[model samples]
Each structure stands twice: as structure tokens, then as C-alpha cells.
Target: MFTEAQLYSPVTRTGDGDVTVHLSTEHPGVHDPAYRARRNAIAACALEYTSGAPTPRIAYTEAEEQVWRTVSIELARKHRGLASAEVLAAARRLALPTDHIPQLDEISAALTPLTGFRYVPAAGLVPLREFFGSFADRIFHSTQYIRHHSAPLYTPEPDAIHEIIGHATQLASPRFAAIYEAAGAAVARLRTDAALKFLADVFWFSLEFGVLREHGEIRCYGAGLLSSYGEIDEFRRAELRPLDVFAMGTGVYDITHYQPILFCAESMSEIEDVIGAFFESMDDETPLRARHLPTHANVPVAQ
Candidate 1:
């Protein structure tokens, strides 16, 4: 499973209103001090935010808005045909701005009524536990910065685009939101770090990068695929395998490149019945007990 630091900028808050980001050198635009400083400032503003407090607003530059616009328009087109029905419906419900970057609060406001999910600011990496555990309360930790202007359609790590467009939209759906909550609860119940890591890996394959077959067509439900301009179209080309918890949890791959393998579900019902049920039933002893159970007993039961 992916770690917060692997996917986000590192955020640190020194005071009530003072937040900073230590951008990784591997990240795009990291060599530009001005750009790095801008990221820090935006994250700082987000740190000052509290529940019910007005969301921190950033005056996005023309370049930043352009990045949002380009990706939003292109991804919208891809989504129309390739995204899961639940995602498309949720995206419509959210009705995110395409001309400019929508403020985090704006997205949260739209999502709250639909699923009670709200966005919180992250300077960079949110601890894995806090990041996933927040789902139990329907809160999502997000970054405020856009991807580098040069690659409006691509980001080395998750940026505002991935957080809002990909995840916020998904959270708008009651079905998906319920699954998220289940996953969070499972995380909280797991006593061993190994179990937690296993759970996170399962989430990685099922929610962050999972795929599904809908009405004879393969569709993307994972945020990582849905928000990606380049990778969304390429996911179908990967080796699509059955959704297996063990393989998903143990498999290792490079994050920097397009995924070469993906887990596919037969349908949305399979996702809920198998993956969702797995989350709802898991605890600290689940994994350990499974290890001792017969192999057939551990396989996904017929839905």
C-alpha cells in the first residue's frame, strides 16, 4: 500500500497559522524555490482551517487555473465513457468547476449533504493511520497545490486534482462512501501494524486503483486511475486479474510508472459483497485466523 509521504508533499505546522511543505526533490518544479514556497503558503493557509471555519482560499494564478482547466476538461471527457456510473453520477452531483481550481471548502460543501464527507488540508504526507482512519468520520485530508504548470495532465504524486476530482467525486456516492467508512473502521479495529498494512494494500487495489466491469465494459473506479489523464486510458491494457485480497496485499510494484497489473471485479455488487464485506468483518484476528483456515474458506465467497 502507498504511504502518505509517497503520494503527497510533507506538511508541517509550526503554529496555528504557520504550515510548511518540504517538497521532495523528485517532485516536479521542486528546483524552483518560488514554486516550492507557493506550495508552502497554500498549505499554511489550509492548516488554519477548522471544522465549520471558512475554507482557506488561495488566489490561484493564471497558470494554475489553466492546469486545472486543461485536466478537468480532458478528464471529464474520459470520465463520460470510461468512469464507473457511480463516479459519473457523483461527479455530476459535485459539479466541480472546470474553468478554475475549486476551493477545498467548495468541494466539501457539495459532498457533505450527499455523504457527509468533508475535506481537510494536508501540507504533505498525512500519517497512514490518520489519513485512512478519517474516513470513519467521512473526512478526507487533501493537498491545496496544483500540479506543475508544465504537466497539467500529469502529476508525479497526488495533488489537488487527484484529491478533489478523483476522491471527492467518489465520496459523493453513498455506496462508495459506505465502503470507505467500512475500510476505516476495519483499520481502527486492526491491532497489528501488519494487519493495517494488509488492509491498506487491499484499499490500494480496490479503491485507489481498482477497476470493474460494467455492462460489458471495463470501467475505472479507483481515484488514481480516474484522475490520471495519461493512465486512465491505459488501465484496460494492464493484466486484469480477479480481485484477491492476498495478492493485492502482498504484490509489489513501482508507483512512479503506469501500473502494469490491476485487479478487476466482475461488478459493483462484487465490490460491495466481497471487498466491502471483507472490510466490515475484519479485525486484528481476522488475518491471523485466516492463515490457519483452509484455503477454500479464505477465498471470496460467491456473492
Candidate 2:
């Protein structure tokens, strides 16, 4: 699993209450002072947010809007042919705007009626426990910053696009929402870091990058694949394997490239029965027991 630092810019607050988002050297916006300032401003909005208060609003720039518009349109087009039927249906029900970025409150309003899920803002990297544990209450912690404008189709970390488009749509689906809550409950029950890490790895493999066979064609439901403009196009080419909890929980993967391996569920029912049930039943001893299982010896290592 990728560390939080590897997946998001770090946010720091000054003694005077100013916020800064430190982009890595390789981040697309690292050299752009204006973009850096925009990130800092957005991060500050999130930092100031309080629970039960209205979600913060961002007045996105035209460049950011254009990036949202471009990627939204392109991803919508791809979703027709590549996304799972369930995801497509959820997308329709959520009916997110494609012409401009929507605020977190707007997404929450849409989702709450459909699946009782709502959005909360995150400055940057949320602690893993807080992040996953929120799901138990049907809450998702999201970042508000848009990706660097230079690459309309790319982002090195989870931005508003990934949070809203990828996750919000999934949360709109009752089935997916239930799975998320189950995973979160499992996190709450876990006592050991190793077990927590194991659960997270299972979630990474299933919810973040999972796939399934629909109408004899492999279709993706994972948010990581659903939101990625490039990775979505390349996932079908990866090695496909049957859904196996032991394999998924212990498997190693790299986050910097298109996933080289994917787990496929026979149907959404299988996902609920296998992944959902696993999350609901897993505990601190689960990973320890998993390691002793014979199947653990065969967990695949990414090539």
C-alpha cells in the first residue's frame, strides 16, 4: 500500500494560522507559484472546517473548471464502455455536473438522499484511522484542491476530481456504500496495526482497483480506475484473477503506474458476499490467522 505522504501533498499550519501545502519536487504544480498559492488557500478552507457545519465552498478558477470539464467529459465517455453497470447507474442518479466543479455540500446533498453518505473536507493526508473510520458513519473525507492546470488529464494525488467523481459516485450506490461502512466498522474493531494494514490492503485491492465480469466483458468499479483518465484505459490489459481474500489482503502493489494485477468478482453479489463479509467479520486476529493460512504462501507479488 502507498503511504499517505506518497499519495498527497503534506499540509502544515503556521503559528499565525496560515496554511501551506508543500508539493513534492515531481508534482506538476511544484514550480508554479500561483498554483501553490491556490492549493494553500483550498487546504486552509478544509482546515477551518468543523464537524456538522456546512461543507466549505471553493470558487474554482476558470483553469480549474476547464480541467474539471475536460476530464469529466472524457471520463463520462469512457464510463459508457468501461465502467460497471452499477457505477453507470449510480453516476446517473448522482447526476454530478460536468461543466463545472461542484462543492462538497452539493455532493453531500445529492448523496445523503440516495445512500445516507456525506462528505467532509481534508486538508491533505488524513490519519488512516480517522480516514477509514469515518466510513462507518457514512462519511468521506475529501480534499478540495484541483490538480495542476498544466495537465488536465493527470494528477499525482487524490484531488477534488478523484474524491468527487470517483468516490461520490460510488457512495451514491447503496451496495457500494454498505461495503464502505462495513470496511469502516472493521477498522473500528481492529486492535493491531498489522491487522489494520491488512484490512487496508484488502480495501485497496477491492474498492480502489477492483474489476468484475459483466456481460462477458471485464468492467471496472474501483474508484481508482473510474477516476483515472489513463489507468482506466489500461486496466483490462492487466493480469486478471478471481477474487481471493488471502491474495488481496497480502498482495503487494505499486501506486505510481497502471496496476499490473486485478481481482475480478463474478458479480456485485460476489463482491458483497466476499469483500463485504470479510470486512464485517475481520478482527485483530484476522491478519495473524491470514498469515498462517496456506493461501498466504501463494500471494502474488507485483511484477
Candidate 3:
């Protein structure tokens, strides 16, 4: 079975600059020729792009627009009750359209004013170093394809929904943007694969899937949970442990399933102090030392 990362990043370019998106048999779009063609067309747009140029635009089909509309309306309803106040405020400021799929350039235009962040197209997997390192420059590499329309609320891989709705809203916040840049800077300072993986794992736990306490509720701040229809409803049921960098950096998780364990912050300030500080100070030796530290005891799972 393909790892979740591999599943999401199935596009590859050949020596001659041709783009091919390999869909696993389990992928919903694998048997659909129309969906496959659309994936190729969208990936080609990213393949043909040059940095600092206008982000490409896609004329989304009515079906595609409907998918976006369905997800946007549903996620908005869930966010009001499950998302962190910081995320809710950022979403309001970003003001993404609920009736149509907003082009990446439009998303960039909004983000640039808020936090100096901009979007660049990715045909698929950007190398780990480049992906994380680009955060230092306020650049986000995003995929442009929507998921197969048959299951609007279920995607086997990260789609445009995950890129724009999941990440763009979080990027709208200055504090979250600062944390992203810090992670990018930490990636630049690291020298080993081990250290990079450690940083990525920490990032996965915190920014991609982190949660925090707000107004007596365990609300979501992580883009992974925020963008996920099912995950938004299920995260509070996961084991909610306190933030522990050592554990977060060294922990193992299966991205394909609802995460069974999560690290929660006492507040947004705690996220900054713990996750932000770790990213700012991390280096090649950090994970080495972290591995030797005793793990924090798990807190009682959220009721």
C-alpha cells in the first residue's frame, strides 16, 4: 500500500517535461477517464508555470464548482462549532467564496495583504526540503485539482479543498504565518535526513493536526482537521495529550486514518511557546537529544 504522502503526491514529470499523475487502484478517480484527463490538464498548468509569474487559472466545470460549494457550506457549518477562534477570525478575514472554487491567484491576493504569503502551483509532491523551506519566503506550493465529484466529502488524497480551505485560512493569521516561517527557517538549519524528518513529524503533529483549548472546548487549529469533513467531527474523540515536543517529534502516525492520538495546547499562547519555540531553535542535534528525553504521561482523553 502507498503511504499517505505517496498517495497524495502521485504526479511525476518525465525527462522530457511530460506530466503523469499515477492513480492507485484504490483511488476514487483511478477508473474514471474524465477525472484522469482533468488531473493531467491541471498538473500541466503547474508544470508550465514559472516563478513570480501569474498563478494559472482553471475554468472549473459545473460539477467541480458544485463540489466546492457543497464542501464550503458544510465546512463553514462545522467550523463555527469546532474551529478555534483564531481560525474562525482568519477565515472571516480571508473571506473565501462559498459558491465557487476560488482560483489560487485570488487566494494569493488575499493572503499577501494579510501575512505576505502567496500560493504557487504544485503538480504534485514538492521535495520535502523545498516545500518546508519555501515557508521561509512566504510561498506555499498548492495542488490545483479538485477531488473526484462522486464523493464530495471524502477524498483519499489532499485536493484543492485541502490546499485552499485547510491551509489558506490558517495562513491568514499573522501568528500562524509566523510559526510557518519559523518551521521553514528550522528546515534550512538542519543538515541530516533524520533531523528533517523530525521537523516534518513535529510539523505534522502541530500545524497539520494540532488542537487547542478554547472557551472550554477542545477546538481545532490544525489545517488537516479543519479541512476534513469527517476529521472535524472526530478529533475531539482522539486521545488529547498536552503539547510535548519530544513526543511529537518522535511519534509515529498513520496519515490515512483518523489520528488516534493528538497533542493539544492549553491555549494559542502555549502553541507559540511550545511549537513555535521548538521550530525556532531546532537543529541537527535537537532530535538526537529529544529521543533520549522521557515521554510525557498522556492526559485523560477528551470526554
Candidate 4:
């Protein structure tokens, strides 16, 4: 369990006043012994947790087999019900192993080839630019580790459940992949903290906690929403809001709890295409909410 202070503290909402981004966890992900030593080496000087720190330390905790199994099984089952048939088909074709509640290794291996997308088990929460940059290179900044069992239902941070499921499956769609890269490239080309935050909001609303319309029915797809058993019911049943609805709220209010409002794209292709164009148009503009990342600090945002 996290210390009492960690459990009750206000989440650190970085950037401007409105869009409160919560740091999900001390980066969670497990790696094989080889990668454990080689990851940073592969990253070279580019690997940084903060501007001042060139290398970030990774943290690990043992999740009893049962605890890990419970979530893994639950996530797989949820994936069946909520994830598109297309994603599940891809999961099967990939023969993706759930590996002892699976870690980043399994996800990275499964995705790296399929979509040129790989998961980077984050050592900790990274700032906007770094996070966006990961996508720019076809890398998904993932927390290979899961949240502590105590968190049970919902947490403010992205853990394995959020990382692997929340975002990866969508990459299976070539159009989505193209759009993702386009968005990342736009951010990479622009290279600023503010633009990254805007993209993050776009990510949070669309990829992490978004709903999509399919075959005359709405579907559960976002990893962030899928992993939370409680949120799943509410999100699936709640009134749907368009993506532009939430885009308007960016940087104005830090969103927490179950998002009362959510934006649904008319179609993945349409959304992805629009997202690409949005990034292109805003390529060099600074976000009003962008700010420099702080080192060795975890600040909680106000609720």
C-alpha cells in the first residue's frame, strides 16, 4: 500500500489551471533482466526523467501471483466485452501472452513489429514533451507495472492496465497508426511544452478515456476507462459528448473523478484525420498551459 500521505494527497495537476494532469504512479513496468540493464543503454543520452537527470531509476514491487492474476484476468475479460472485435482478433493473432499478469516486455514485443509501436516501461511519470516524443518515435511510454492492489478500482495514474490496454490496441488500425505518428511528428517538429500538453489532453480524452461509435452502437475502448470496473459502467451508460466539447475545456480545469463529460469522434478515421490536421495547424503554437517539468517531485492536483 502507498503511505497514508500518498493515498490521500491531492494529485499533482501540472501546467495551467484548467487541465489537471495526474501522475499515475512512480513508473510501473517489469522488464526481463537483460532489458533491465539494457533499456537505458539503448536510450543513450536521450533517456531522461527530468531536464537535470539524464537517467531515471526504475522501481519494482512483487505482486503476489493472485493479485496480478486477478487484474490480468479481469482485464482480458473486459477486453473481450469492451474492446473491438478487431483488437481482440489482433490480440489473438499476436498470441499476446498475459505473462504473469504480463509486464511491458510482453506488450512491447507484441506491438513493436505489428505497428512500429513499442511500449517503454516508464521509470516514472514523464512531462508532456517527453511523453509526446515517445509517440513521435513509435514508442508508447508505458508503465509496465500495475498499481498496488490497494488501489483496486481506480487510480490517478496509468499502470499496466492503462498502458497496454488503454492505448495500444488502437495502433492495430493503420489509419489510427498514421494519425498517431502524425500527431507525434507534429509535436516533435514543434517541440515545446505547451503543444505537448494540448496533445496530452487530446490523448486523455480520445485514447485513454474515449468512447467510439461503431455499428450503430457505442463501444468501450479506452484503456483508462476499461481498466476501472466502476468507471466502465458509468462511462458506457453516461451521455456522450463530442470531442470538441472537451477540447474546449483544455487547460481551464483539471479533470478528475469520472469525467462527467466525454467527447466521441464520429469515426476513428474522421477523428484520427482531424487530429492529424489539428496537430499540423497548431504545429508551432505554444500552449497556454505548458510549463517546465520539475525533478524528483510528485505534486498532486487540487480536486
Candidate 4, residues 1-303, lDDT tens digits: the string is 111123221223225422222232442222233323333332322233333232232343344334456666676787776665555665565554454545555666667777787665454455557666667678777554345455444555555565655567666555556667776777667765555556666666766667777676666656667667667767766556655512432523234466665566556665656555566555545344223212111221111
Per-candidate Cα lDDT values, in order, are 0.83, 0.90, 0.90, 0.54
TM-scores for the candidates: 0.91, 0.96, 0.96, 0.67
- Model 1 lDDT tens row, 1-303: 545357666677765656667767777788877887888888777766776777777899998999999999999999999999888988888899899898888888899999999888876677778888889998898888898887777788888999998899889889999999998888788778888887888888889899998888889999989899999999988888887766776668778888988888888889999789989998877666655543431343222
For candidate 1, the lDDT comes to 0.83
Q: What is the lDDT ranking, best to worst?
A: 2, 3, 1, 4
- 283: Cα error in model 1, Å: 0.9
RMSD of each: 3.2, 2.3, 1.8, 11.0
Provide the clash count, candidate 2. 0
Model 1 stretches astray by more than 4 angstroms = 12-20, 50-52, 290-303
Instruction: Assess the local accuracy of residue 117 in candidate 1 as a C-alpha lDDT between 0 and 100.
Output: 90
Kindly list the per-residue Cα lDDT of model 2 for residues 188-228, writing each as its tens digit.
99887878778888888889999998988999999999999
- How many residue pairs clash per model? 2, 0, 0, 19
Q: Candidate 4, which segments miss by more than 4 Å at Cα?
A: 1-64, 245-255, 285-303
Cα displacement (Å) at residue 105, model 2: 0.3
